[model samples]
Target: MNAHTKGKARSTRVKEGMTVKVVRGQHKGKQAKVSEVNTKKSTVYLEGIEATRRDGQKAPIPIHTSNLFVEAQK
Candidate 1:
C-alpha cells in the first residue's frame, strides 16, 4: 500500500460534493460546492470557481483545504 492508505486515516476535513466557504484569497466569502478533493495535496476544486486564462478559457482552481470551511454537505 502507498503511504496515504498504509497506516492511518487522513485528517482531511473536506470531501467531494461538500459545500464550503472560501475563508481567504481573492474568492474569500464565496460559497461553492466541492467538486473534487486531493488528499495528497490537501487541496480542493470547487464547482463554479475558476480562474480565467489569458486566452479567455476558464480552468479549475485548486484551493487549499485549510483556506476553506465546510458549510454543508450534499
Candidate 2:
C-alpha cells in the first residue's frame, strides 16, 4: 500500500474468478475459485465453499483476505 496523505486504507484488489486457498483456519488447505469479493467488508466468497445454514441450505461464509492465498489470477 502506498502512503496516503489522508491515512485512508487501501482497498483489496481481489476479484471474482481468482483461485485461492484457505491457509490459517479450520478450512485450511481448501481451495476454490473466488465467487465474490466484498472489499468494503474485506471478505471473500469462495465457489463450492460454504457452511450449512440453520435452515439446511448452504451459505457462503465470508473469508477474510488475510486467510486466503491466491493460487490463480483472474
Candidate 3:
C-alpha cells in the first residue's frame, strides 16, 4: 500500500502552480510548473509533462505525488 492508501497524500504540500520535479518513474528528473492537483487520486498534472496520444493530441498524465518533489512555488 502507498501513502494514498493511508490518505496522507490528500494533505500533500505540493499545490497547483508550484514547480515540481519528477523524482521517480519514467519522467524522472523532469521539472515543470504544476498545472493542477487531484487530491482525490493523489495525482498532480505538470505543465511540461505530457504524452502524445495515438490521435495526435498531447495529454498530461496524472502522476502520483509520491513520484514528485516540489522544487518551488510558482
Candidate 4:
C-alpha cells in the first residue's frame, strides 16, 4: 500500500511533553503539545488534539508518535 493508505505509526524514544505536529490522519495540519506517553501501545496524548463529535467533545483517540513530527519552539 502507499503512504497515504497507511495510517498512523509508532516509533521509539519519544518522551512526554514534547511539542509535535500531526503528519497524518484526520487531525493533520494541527499542532499540539504532548501530554502523555504510552510505551507499550506506542501512543501519545497531544493536548487540545483529538477527534471530536458535532458537539466538539474530544473523542477517545491517541495518535502514534511516528504519525507526529516533533516541532521546535520559537
Candidate 5:
C-alpha cells in the first residue's frame, strides 16, 4: 500500500477542534480542545496541554489517540 492509503486506513476517531479527555498519562482527567492530529504517528495535540521547557517555553506534546476520548464536537 502507498503512504497515503496507509494514512487513510489508520484514521483516528478524534478530529481537530473537538474536546477530548485524556484517558492516561500525567495529564489524565484533563479536558481540552483538539488542536492537531498526526495520523502517521497516531497522536493528537490538544490546546493548553503541553510540556514546559527549562527555558519556560511550552512545547507541543503529541499524545497517542488511544489515550484520549472525544468529549464534545466543535
Candidate 6:
C-alpha cells in the first residue's frame, strides 16, 4: 500500500457519510458530512465545504484531519 493509504488506514476511525466539523481553516467552525475517504490520497472529502474552483477564483481549502477534530458522540 502507498503511504497515503497506510496513513488513512491508521488514522481514520469514522467511515464515509459521517458528520464532521472543521476545526481549522477558512471554513473552520463549519459543519459538513464526510463525503469520501481516500486512503490512497490521504484526503477526506467534506461535501459542500471544501475549496473549489469557482468563477476562476480559488479560495483557501478546508482543513485536513491534521487540522480537523472529529466530534463523535456516543
Candidate 4's residue-wise lDDT over 22-56, tens digit each? 98998898888788888899898888866778998
Q: Of 3 and 4, which scores higher on TM-score?
A: 3
| Model 2's TM-score against the true structure | 0.79
Q: What TM-score, computed on C-alpha atoms, does each candidate reach?
A: 0.78, 0.79, 0.79, 0.66, 0.78, 0.58
lDDT of each: 0.88, 0.86, 0.87, 0.77, 0.88, 0.64
Which clashing pairs does model 5 show?
Answer: none
Tens digits of per-residue lDDT for model 2 on 1-74? 55586686444477899989899887899999999889899999998888998999999989999998878787
Cα displacement (angstroms), candidate 3, residue 5, comes to: 27
lDDT of 5 at 21: 92
lDDT of 3: 0.87
The list of candidate 5 runs beyond 4 A from truth reads 1-12
Model 5: number of backbone collisions: 0
Model 6 Cα displacement at 7 (Å)? 23
Query: Which residue pairs in candidate 1 collide?
Result: none
Superposed by TM-score, candidate 6 places the C-alpha of residue 21 at a distance from the truth, in angstroms, of 0.8
Cα lDDT of candidate 4 equals: 0.77
Q: What does the lDDT come to for candidate 1?
A: 0.88
lDDT of 1 by residue, 1-74 (tens): 87687886544478788889999998999999999889999899999999999999999999998899877866
Ranking of all predicted structures according to lDDT, beginning with the best and ending with the worst:
1, 5, 3, 2, 4, 6
Number of clashing pairs per prediction, in order: 0, 0, 0, 0, 0, 0
Better of 1 and 5 by lDDT: 1
* TM-score (C-alpha, index-matched) for candidate 3: 0.79
Worst 10 residues of 6 by lDDT: 58-67
